[model samples]
Target: MSAPVRADALATLTAWRPADPGQRALREAFLGFLAARPDSCARSCEPGHLTASALVLDATGDQVLLTLHPRVGAWLQLGGHCESTDATLAGAALREATEESGIEGLTIDPVPLHVDVHPITCSLGVPTRHFDVRFLVRAPAGARETRSEESLDLRWWPLDAPPDHELDDLLAAAQIAR
Candidate 1:
């Protein structure tokens, strides 16, 4: 297994702000879900574990930054597993955004926008349930693009008419939610 990422480093990502009502409600619901089934991680959601991620919206609020996922061949948000280094789930999401998107100076909300529990296929072929904590992020105004090896491609698309053809069901759901 790879070395776990650090939480304190993740915490240094960005500042936080009060979450909106909708976001707070979502967070509460997610927490409740976790509380109800304490062993969901090791049992129901085995193989995969809890994760955090960020969906970066561009300046105009009409487009989002997406990565062309290599394995699934879909355009998706930036995120990864919540490693030991993550200060909090939100911090992990921000760290993922900065590392994967290569976009600097992203402003992130401290609270998650939504928490989704879903199964995803990894390279190993076993279906793993990812307890995904998602946050909304915004890049600096007029920020330029940057690329990383993890992505096949990175681009901004109009939210109104996203490139759905290049996305999978989960990513498509995220697009529609935005």
Candidate 2:
């Protein structure tokens, strides 16, 4: 595992310009958490861990690719826990997006579009929080996707007609409109 991932995370957060007061607060909390736990990027960190996620859009940015998460039973953006091999948060998010969507050649925005702290019983089978750093990803034109075992379903939803969920706030924050 690269120890630089933690440093990369701290740098990413420190350089990030939060979109709102809530985002600003989360960014501060994330910085504090990283300062305290050197292993915060690993899933085994117990109380919580840093996670990377990507919200994938088509080349034209008119459509989004989402997965029906088996764990959450809801269609959500593609992303998950950072791996030992990941060197940066943006890389981790892109890696998860690729692994889960089976789509290669995706372009990622290094800056995070959102930060969220949510509690769940992850693969560890224990309750923990996910300090998710979400990035925006753009797929190549005519991009084809295959569903990986990590998801129950995978498909593209038009931005104008997204699934009923929290993607609304995400879109709003990213300033993406139909």
Candidate 3:
């Protein structure tokens, strides 16, 4: 419900095109939360806790590697929390991709592609918020991958026909902008 989060959620929801009933509901709920809680802050079940994540593009710049998130069952970029050990947000993103995708020789652009703020409804029905700072990264030339346990599946996807998911539009936009 912070101003930044509210703005991000608003933009995301407006640009979103949900492909399934469940995703539509989820998207609506997220949009509604932002509309209702313009100033709710982190404590109000609003998106908070900044996390650094990445959309890893391959060396040729035609494909992006994505992971199938365990909980969400959706294809997404590799990223995680910026723990105390991380020197900067970009470092956190690098560590996460290295750990999650097992792809070596990567370089991340310091600038974030987008700031995604979303509320993750946990199994216990407790919602955790994430203000995800998403960066654009590139794998070394001809670098191969070994998907880690963190992802159900990891593979390179074309920028135009990324695997079906709710964030497809956002991902496409990010790729084009990059």
Candidate 4:
């Protein structure tokens, strides 16, 4: 709802460089969306909105913290809509990871690991595309987590094996980033 987050989202997308042509294309589209819509980061924005999320890894980087998102009915990483208090897209990613994981001492790579666009029904009660910027977060060694209401269940899985097959490429990118 504030200008800072929207500004940050614009700058973040502008400055990002990805090796993949596909990601590059998405990044360009996201930049265009941000430039045209002042409310790009807000839930009120129609058709599409920017969401930040993180692929959480343990200190050893061998395990990943995943949540059973009730709305999506799938095991996914921690992250959500950018809040009014967020000053940057990276901070919003960190906030979502911490809130959904209930774990402290989590460190994040400020640069995005990946960006995705997926159609879903969100709080707006209509179909929209989530322009998700994904980052990598590392939890403290053997860090304990408390389940937040946002998840149907939260747990850590071996990095090599996740409940979602779609995460394979994203997780690989995260591993390289970390």
After superposing candidate 3 on the true structure, give the runs of residues whose Cα lies further than 4 Å from its correct spot.
1-47, 121-125
Query: Could you give candidate 1's per-residue lDDT for residues 44-92 as a string of tens digits?
Result: 3455556777878887666788888897687877887665555566677
CA RMSD of each candidate after superposition: 6.3, 1.5, 7.3, 0.9
Q: For residues 88-149, what per-residue lDDT tens digits would candidate 3 score against the true structure? A: 66677889988887877899976556656677863335778765667788899888889887
Question: Which stretches in model 4 have alpha-carbon errors above 4 Å?
Answer: none
On TM-score, the leading prediction is 4
Of 1 and 2, the candidate ranking higher by lDDT: 2
Error of 3 at 85 (Å): 0.5
Candidate 2 deviant stretches above 4 angstroms: none
* Regions of model 1 farther than 4 Å from truth: 1-33, 36-47, 123-125, 165-178
Error of 1 at 159 (Å): 1.6
2 versus 3: better TM-score goes to: 2
- On a 0 to 100 scale, what is the lDDT of residue 108 in model 2? 95
Candidate 2's residue-wise lDDT over 50-121, tens digit each?
999999999988889999999988888999998889999999999999999888899999999998998989
- The C-alpha lDDT values of all candidates are 0.64, 0.89, 0.70, 0.91
Tens digits of lDDT, candidate 4, 1-178: 9799888888888889999999999999999988888888998898799999999999999899999989999988899998999999999999999998889999998888999999999899899999999999999987998899999999999888898797887888877776
Candidate 4 local distance difference test against the native: 0.91
User: What is the lDDT for 125 in model 2?
Assistant: 93
lDDT of 2: 0.89
Look at candidate 2 and give me any clashing residue pairs: none
